[model samples]
Target: MSFRVLRCLFQSTVSLTLLTLAIAPNSSMAQSLPYLEDPPPPPSRTSQRVRRSNPELDEYTLGPGDLVQIEIFEAPEYSGEAQVLANGMMDLPIGGRVYVEGLTIPQATDIIAAEYVRIFRYPLVSVRLSGPRPLQVTIDGEVTQPGAYVMEIPLKAQSGLQRGLQYPTVPELIELAGGVTLSADLRRVEVRRNSGNGKEPSFYIDLLSYIQSGRRGQDITLRDGDALFIPTAERIEEERVRQLAATNFAVAEDSPRSVVVVGAVNQPGNYVLIGGPSRSELRPGGLPTLTFALEQAGGIVTNADVRQVEIRRITQTGGEQIIIANLWEFLQTGDFENDPILQNGDTIVVPRTDAIDSAEVAQLANASFSASIVVYVVGEVNKAPSIRTLEVPTNTTLNQAILQAGGFTDDANRDEVDFIRLNPDGTVRQETIELDFARGIDEFENPLLRPNDIIVISRSGLARVTDTLETIFSPAPEINSFMRILETLGIVGD
Candidate 1:
C-alpha cells in the first residue's frame, strides 16, 4: 500500500467515529451532561394597591360653633338664632341650656319642640341649620406647612360626579396648609380616623391615582379632628412626577422660591429664584446663574474665601445636602459646568479666606461670580503711610497695587518686601519675596493680591538707623539740648 492509501484509510476511520458520537441517543448523553434551562423572569416591581375609606357625610353630627335657627308656626316670639356653646349646650327661652351637641339637626329640633310643649299647648316648631362651624383638622408630614387649619364650611352642591354635598376634601386641606412640598410622596396619603370604638383606623389614599384618573371616590372629605399625614418621597424618580403631570393633575411650581446667600459676600440675603420662563424675561440675561446671585448680593467682600463656597440644599426627608463649590477653579477654567444650578430653598455660604478648607473645596464649582473684590496694599509706598488702608479689585498683581499706591519710597528695600496673608485657621502667614519694578508685573514675581493681603516694603539699613536716631532725640529734651550743645561746640554735626 502507498502512503496516499494509508492516509485515506485513517481519515475514513476518524470520520466514522465522529458520525457515531453525533448520532448518540439523548439518554446516553444525559448521563454524562447536565441539563440547562433559561433563567426565570425577574420579580415584579409594582406596589400594592392602597386601601381607601370615605367618610360618612349623611350622618354628620353637630359640634361646637355651629349656629341653628328655630321657628314657631303660630308664634313669632319663639323663633330666634342660637349657637352651640363650647360645652355642647344651647340656651332657649323654654329650655335652660339643653345639651344639643352630637345630635343631628332633626334630632335637636325634636328636643327643642318637646321643651316648647312645656311652655305652650301643641306648639308646632321647626329647626334649620344656619351655618356650619369651621373644620379644625390637623395635617402633618411632607407638606410645605404642617399644622392645624380652621377651614370654613366649604361644602356646597356641585354638578357632575361631585353632585352630592361636598365638604373640605384632602386636597383642600393640603392647600390650606400651603400645599405639598417637593419631597411629598403623593402616592401615600394617610388619613387617621377614630372608629368610635376607641380604635384609630388608618386609610391610605393614592393621590397619584386620583390625580391621574380623576376618580370620584379618591378625594376624601376631611372630618373634624381627622389627622392627615403625607409621606415623603425619599426614593421617587423624576419620571413618576412627569407621569402624574401627564394626567389631569396640574403640578404647580413653587412661587417666590428664594435662595439665601450668607457669610463673606458683600450683601447676604434671600434672593428670589427666577426659574422657568420668568428667567428669560430678564433684560438680555438668559437665566439666573451664580454670577447673577452674587451680583444681586453686591458681590463677595474682600475677605471672602471663594475656594469653599457651600451650597446647602434640603433633601426629601427634611435633611440637608451640602455641596461645596470652589469658585476659584471655576474662574480659572472658565467652565460653566463647574457652577451649580441654584434651586429653591438653597443656601449659598461664602466663608472667609481663613475658613476655606479641603472639605469645602471638594464641593461643586461656581466661581466667576464676583466683581468689586478688593485687595489691600500697605507699608513703604508713597501714600501707604497716610492712606495705609487701600483696596483694589481682585487679581490685581503685587506690582500694580504698589504702583497704584504712588510707587515705593526712595529708601524702600524692594528685595525684602514682606507679604502677609491669613490662613484658613485664622493664623497670620508671612512671606518674603524679591521684586524688580523695571521688569513689569507680567515678567516678574508679581503674585496676584488676594483679599485682606498686606504688603510691607522694609526701609534700607541707613534709613532705619536715621529714623531710630531721630526718634530717640526728638522725645528727650536733655538729649536734644546736649546734641545742640555738641553741635554748637562743633563736636557733633547737625
Candidate 2:
C-alpha cells in the first residue's frame, strides 16, 4: 500500500482505540498509560539571567522626568500615560499616587496591578517606557577642560526593556572634557553617583589597567548627577607619561603649548611650541623634550651646561617642581630619558657652564639642540655681510668672527675690541677684551660668540690721529668760514 493510505489506516485505528479506552477508563490498557501526567515547571527569570556590567542599560530605573505607559486589556479608563514626579511618585488612575522611582518598569507594573486587584477581579496589565530624560554629569581635575556637561538621551521601549542603547562611559566623559593631561593619574579616578536618596556613593576605577589591557572590566556607564574626578599625577615618571601621551585619552601631540626657555639659551623667552617626538632613535616612542623646547626658543648657547638642565614645572599644589634634564647623556648614549618631555608652562633653564672646553664647544655646536646664532660686527669690517651681522655656528669665537668679517680694516684696532652683550635681565654689559688676532681661539682671550653679540672694532692710534689732523687741515673749514662771512654781508642774497 501507498504511504498516504498506510497513514490514514493508522490514524483510524488510533482513533478507535482511544474511543475504546475512553469508554473503559478503569480497564488494564488504560491503567498502563501515563501520557496524561503534568510536566515540570520552567525556571524563573532571576535564576536564568546574570546582572549586566552596565547598570544604566541593564534595567530602566524610573525617575523624575520619565514617561511611562500602562495598558489594561478591557479597562481603558484605568490604563493610560503617567509621569514620575520629582518626589519619585507617579499618579495613576486607580492608585492615586504610587512611588515608582528607582524601581524597574515591570516592578512598577506588578505594584500597580496589585493595587487595582481590589477593584477589578481580573486585570491583565502591561507597562512600557516611552521617554527618558537627559543626563547631566561633571568631570573635573587633570582634564584639559573641567566643567559640567549635558548628554541628551532619547529612548523608546516596545517590550519594556533597554535594547541597543549605548550608554556613555568614563573615558567618553573625559574626552568631552578635552582629554586628560599627560600628568593625569588614571589609577584613582573617582566617581560620585547620586541616587534619589540623600546619600551619594563613591567608587574608584583604574583606567591605567583598562588602557593597558582592552578588557572593559570597570569602565562603567555614567548616570545623571554623576561627578567624575581625575586627580593630578604625583610623579610623571611613575605613571610612564610617554605611554599615556600615546593614548586617546591624552591631549593631542600637535596642540600648541606655551613654554618659557631662559638661561644660557638664544632668544630666551616665551614661545608657542607644537610638535611630536623626533629624537628617540634607540627606544620606540618619544615626546617633545627639553632639547625640543630649546630648539623652539632659537637654540642653546655655546656654553650651556646640558648636564644640569633645570625644568621648573608648576604642580597642582601651585608649587614649583624642579626636574634636572641631562641632554649631554642623551647626545652620548642616545637615551631619551635624559631629555624629559615638556609640558605647558614648563620653564627650561639651561645654566651656563663654569668653564668652556673647545672640544665640547665644537660638539655642542654640532648637536641637534644647538642652533646657528647671528652676531653683529661693526666698526671697520672689511666684509660687507659681517659689517652688519654674521650668521655663524654657536661655537664661533672672537677670532673666528673677526676673520669671517674679512679680518677687519687696516685702521681696525688689533689691540683691544669692545664686546657688547645684552643680558637676559634687560641689561647691556659691555666689556673691552684685549685682542691678539694671531692667537688661537681660547676661553678667555678669544671667547665664543653669542647670539646678537655686538663686536666693536675700534680705530688704531695713528688712524685716530690722522683723522683728527684731516679735520684741521681740510679746505672745507676755510670754505665754511668764508660762507658764513658771505651770509653776514648778504653777498648770497636770499
Q: Which one is best on lDDT?
A: 2
For every model in order, what is the number of clashing pairs?
4, 0
Candidate 1 lDDT score relative to the true structure: 0.63
lDDT of each: 0.63, 0.73
lDDT of 2 by residue, 384-478 (tens): 65366889999898888887888878898888889888866799978898988677667567888878889998899999878766654556666
Off by over 4 Å in 1: 1-59, 70-127, 142-146, 154-189, 194-221, 230-375, 379-387, 408-416, 424-426, 436-444, 458-494
Least well predicted 10-residue stretch by lDDT in candidate 1: 43-52
Task: Put down candidate 1 lDDT per residue, 323-409, tens digits, no spaces.
Answer: 666667677786553455554687888887644332333222223355554556666778735346665655466777778888878
Judged by lDDT against the true structure, how good is candidate 2?
A: 0.73
TM-scores of the candidates are 0.51, 0.71
Off by over 4 Å in 2: 1-60, 73-81, 93-96, 152-165, 194-201, 214-219, 275-289, 315-320, 367-369, 410-441, 458-474, 477-494
